[model samples]
Target: MRFSDFALGLGVAVFGIAVLLHVRTFPEIPGMQYGPAFFPGLIGAAFLICGVALVVGSVVRGAALTERFAERPAWFGDRLAVWRAVGVVLSVVAYALVSPVLGFLLTVALLTAGLLLLMGVRWVVVVPLMVLLPLFLHYGFAQGLRVPLPRGPLELLLF
Candidate 1:
């Protein structure tokens, strides 16, 4: 997908404005000079400046600034790309529904494997990553972050 500099700039400016506005409500840390909002506020200011620059650049260049961002994407005619995109959406939906029942490890493993296969990854590479990646992620989130993961029969045994 592509967007005219004008539209993209406007979007960035709006987002920056939103961030700056919302960050004002965050209370300053009692002991520290930099509050939670400090870094984000700086980022928002940067975004605002860059967005204005893009808008100005587009205006100066006299490009088609009013054109719709996504009239027809470059990949519109690519069937495989379209299907892969659909598969990603479907995968997310499937994960939401199946994760609770199958648990985090199993659900993520299945999702990773399925997506890898769909993307035409070799079985040799897919098999190891399918098992290892989910395990590592589960350990990191569940153990390191102390986040509670949904436990199914398999995880009930391991975790």
Candidate 2:
């Protein structure tokens, strides 16, 4: 738990620094209004505060925390779960990289396909989901949130 606290604290510190750098790039708004950096800065500060609280709480309660977050053994017993987490992280990274080039819908479709395939889902089920998830996400994000996503190579085919 102490080690977790140390790691989280370090991560939060680094994230806060990153947010600060981003904030510096934006021009200040007039009339005390919020600027582009407002939300990200707020989120970064929240992360920093939560991290500090976790470290402090861990210090106060460390002796009493006998069971690690879950009851499973540390190493080999949880290897599969750890690998799944790693796969998810990699998938997200892949989506981020591909989204600009392949477009949001295609990237999301690929992400869904990869995840479903890795989870042992059948191709019949996986293929439909791969096609549907991206369409759903595109509508949800673009129509619902009013945020536009890149169309990339599929723009002509889609629109």
Candidate 3:
């Protein structure tokens, strides 16, 4: 846990520096109260602050935290969970790469299907979930939030 805290602290410090760099370059846009970089800059600052706190807390409670984890069964130490997590991360990367080409509807639906399958959901349930989720998201964002969705060939065929 000490190592985890150290890594998180280091990562957040690096991320904060990266965001600060972009915010420095972000040009001011008129009429809006905040520029494009405002929210991300805020988040990066928050992350840096929280990371420092975590590192300090970890140092204070180091021995106790190590004892707690040591009490857990050896079976819980299986590192395969990390590989499984990597697959989920890769799935998101795949979605980003394909979203523009496949468009929002198809890309989101495929992502839902892939995630459900990865989680061991059967095809019978996965199919309906994959189809309905993207439609639900479309309604939630496009209709409710008044956000326009990217339309590709699917729009031409469906609507």
- Among the numbered candidates, top lDDT falls to 1
Total backbone collisions, model 2 = 0
Tens digits of per-residue lDDT for model 2 on 12-99?
7678777867787888788767888888888878777877776666667763254244344464467766776777999989977888
**What is the lDDT of every predicted structure here?**
0.89, 0.75, 0.75
- RMSD to the true structure for each prediction, in A, is 5.6, 7.4, 7.6
Order of models, best lDDT first: 1, 3, 2
Q: Residue by residue across 10-94, what tens digits does model 3's lDDT show?
A: 6777787778777878877888879988988888788778777766766787742453322444534766555557668998898
Q: On residues 79-103, what C-alpha lDDT tens digit does candidate 1 reach at each position? A: 8888889889999999889989999
Each prediction's number of clashing residue pairs: 0, 0, 0
lDDT of 3: 0.75
State how far residue 70 of model 1 sits from its true place (Å): 3.6
Which regions of candidate 3 deviate over 4 angstroms? 1-80
- TM-score of each model, in listed order: 0.61, 0.52, 0.52
